[model samples]
Target: MGFSSRTFLVAPDDTLWRLSTSKFDRMLRDPASHSLPTFARQRARMASVVVELVASEPMRVMRTTYSVLAFDAEGRLDPSRFEEQQFALVESVVAPVIASSAEENNQPVVDATARFIAQGGRWTPSPALARAIDEAALEQRPCGRL
Candidate 1:
């Protein structure tokens, strides 16, 4: 089995513009930038910038998708194992992003993203994850509030 994921972080407002002009996205779109060494270095730099931005801003939105494949010892498709892996991915990968966004954004944006992995595979986030995000958002009160 193999796992893969990608994450996009952007401000809620002007999402389209931000994504279009983002350095990472621009690099991806440009064919000339596809050299292995150059791409690797640029990717590292972009990731560093994202980390810094997320750490500093609460309102930035993070969009992410992950995929995994699983099979039993007999080579039978294992939906149960795949689902378990999906939940594990959410807990380990998505939870930290939610926590960061809530700490900075001051509100929870409950937009459900449908995740499809390989053929005939689908994963939806758990309700508990949503609730935790909401709670985190609520913890950030107004400046003057008690």
Candidate 2:
């Protein structure tokens, strides 16, 4: 498999970690290996996770951050899903696509970010979601984009 071009908006909290490890464990057991379906599932899962974080705001921030960071280390996202998909992964599946035989954890995130931005810059968080986070922050909850 090759790298997929995608970007995601994940919530920042513990739920993100839960989603990542769960999916990573599942992928490790997937005998199908590197196929489109596996990648698609991971991608969908990542989207689900991010959307959830986006919906919850401050309460889920830390988990969302960890999830994004972890996935940022290993999974590829499905860019088009940013504004379309609902119910994303509890965390995220961010990482690079690997061939069946490749084990190197050296994919450059800078390159990936560059590519994502080149494709369409960063995703603007939904205005409503941003507003909610701001309100939560004022209440000392402090939810920000992850």
Candidate 3:
């Protein structure tokens, strides 16, 4: 039996080292937090015999399933349900077509940022990305090719 087993924990002590009635009475007088209903209610409540909840905070209940995320019957998320089908379609079809066209004609510069993204790296844009605040303001004119 495991050490956690309440039955296996409490032994008759094969010797005469039984729990003192005076000490047991003192322990009962002290404010005790309820742990084991059976052992607490019983006349003889020992440390090893009864399970004591030694925690300041309530512990989370043991989960039936190992994974934190819940899955459907098919065990996968449907892209359509999440409205991600458009993105998937663009990635599979439109993105490849545009990339091929750019590679053949434009031969676009594969800079560090582009290279990082191509290798599956991701980043969130922030106000720091804009240097317009630091740069001199352009004179107002009709928008045309430089």
- The number of the candidate with the highest TM-score is 2
Give lDDT: candidate 1, residue 60. Answer: 31
**RMSD (CA, angstroms), candidate 1:** 19.5
Q: Global lDDT for candidate 1?
A: 0.32
Candidate 3, 1-146: lDDT as tens digits: 11111111111231111233343333334324212222222222112122222343222221110001111333332223222423333354455566778888977734333333222312222343111111101112111110
What's model 3's lDDT at 10? 17
Q: Which of candidates 1 and 2 is the stronger one according to lDDT?
A: 1
lDDT of 2 by residue, 1-146 (tens): 11111122344331211223434434435424422232333422232222223434323322222112212223434333332222232111233343211445544343343244323322334556444433343334333232
Worst ten-residue run, lDDT, model 3? 62-71
- Candidate 1 ranges beyond 4 A from true positions: 1-66, 101-146
- Per-candidate TM-scores read 0.21, 0.22, 0.18
Task: Highest lDDT: give the candidate number.
Answer: 1
Q: Model 3, which residues run further than 4 Å from truth?
A: 1-81, 109-146
- Please list the C-alpha lDDT of all candidates, in the order they appear: 0.32, 0.31, 0.26
Q: After the best TM-score superposition of candidate 2, give how far the Cα of residue 9 lies from its true spot, in angstroms.
A: 9.5
lDDT for residue 102 in candidate 1, whole number 0-100:
85
Clashing residue pairs in candidate 1, if any?
58-104, 58-105, 59-105
